[model samples]
Target: MRLLPRLLIILFVIFAPLPAFAVNPDEMLSDPALEARARTLSAELRCMVCQNQSIDDSNADLAKDLRLLVRERITDGDSDDEVLNYIVSRYGEFVLLKPRFSVRTLLLWGAPVLLILAGGIALIVFARKRAGKPTGSKLTEDEKARLAELLEK
Candidate 1:
């Protein structure tokens, strides 16, 4: 019946994006505190091969390796900063999406906003100048009479 199709659609909508358990369930920590730390480190660590993605969400083999590495480092008592520094040292910063604020990244952080502000100022001045101006020449009475006469003929 029509109701069966509706039910199937509802089920599909509810479960369409469930995460794939590609990671071995055994690899997950049973201790909540350690698992929380693992997640924090995972979010901080970028996947070397998949440069834009964090290791936690990426399904790439390298991401898995990075996740395992993060857990290993955390277990070895590395602070989050130490783990981040270690990755940055090896990957040379391209792996990070959110780069640290520095002289090299100044343009990336400031250019778009500066461009937008410059554009907005230009637009405001342009609009004001345009709005203040007359659209056409103002005709004298004689000129209007001549135009009327020309139109009549």
Candidate 2:
């Protein structure tokens, strides 16, 4: 009887734990195609509660809601752009890893390269100015001779 109980306990532990990728079956799409779409869309969405995590990777309540939103939009026959735009409108562009390039964000897009070029030019100008310094003494031969004679004494 004691051995049977131990075996049962081992079986319960082995069967009870779920895999990391396991999702609630009700949340899964019956159609594999639609499920793929859900997975792809969810990966793009940021989890608001976990700023750096995608909705698909996060177990947060907000991530769950966002995942449900993606599936609902896909079921409604919305295009990917429409689904993404819906989230962007609610959360602002900060949710996107790669923000849209625009005139308002021109510096954000261009500043690093521009700053590097400017710094390179400034460094060259500084180096040239330093390099151009007179490489020899300006003193007359008489000064040199006097210094040499003093040293000899």
Candidate 3:
């Protein structure tokens, strides 16, 4: 019983920091509403340096810069959409963690499914071809006669 409690404590200590925010205290906004908006925007923006992590979760220098930029925009009285549009205009849509569904992004999203479907179709066709055919050449009449003569001998 004592061992279980100790193990739980150890696990908690090890995993607790994983979900902690990477935002520095110095960069935080004074207004709670603006700060909340900044935090939300940070979570939606991608860390360009880290590629896969959100700016709010990444410890990279670029991520820190982006977090500050978001706060600055919020403090300047920009609406959430304006902040997002400004960032998108500067960095292109690739800066957004969730890209808008448009023609370009649709191709990015659809390519994998299309490839998998194509591969599945190819596999089915190959399997059918293999199953339907017995790939052997028929012997000529002369070869059959020679085989019969040899067997009789």
Which number leads on TM-score?
3
lDDT of 2: 0.82
The TM-scores, one per candidate, come to: 0.73, 0.66, 0.74
Write model 2 residue lDDT over 86-137, tens digit each, in one string.
Answer: 9889998766556678786788889999999999999999999999898877
Task: Estimate, for each residue in 29-72, the C-alpha lDDT of model 1 and write its tens digit.
Answer: 77778778888777766677777777787889988887777677
Candidate 3 residue-wise lDDT, 24-132, digit = tens: 8998988888899999999999999998989999999999999999998888889999999999999999999999889989998898999999999999999999999
**Winning model by lDDT:** 3
Q: By TM-score, highest first, what's the ranking?
A: 3, 1, 2
Between 2 and 3, whose lDDT is larger? Answer: 3
Cα RMSD of all models vs. native, in order, equals: 4.5, 8.4, 5.0
Clashing pairs in 2: none
lDDT of all predictions: 0.79, 0.82, 0.93
Sort by lDDT, best first: what order? 3, 2, 1
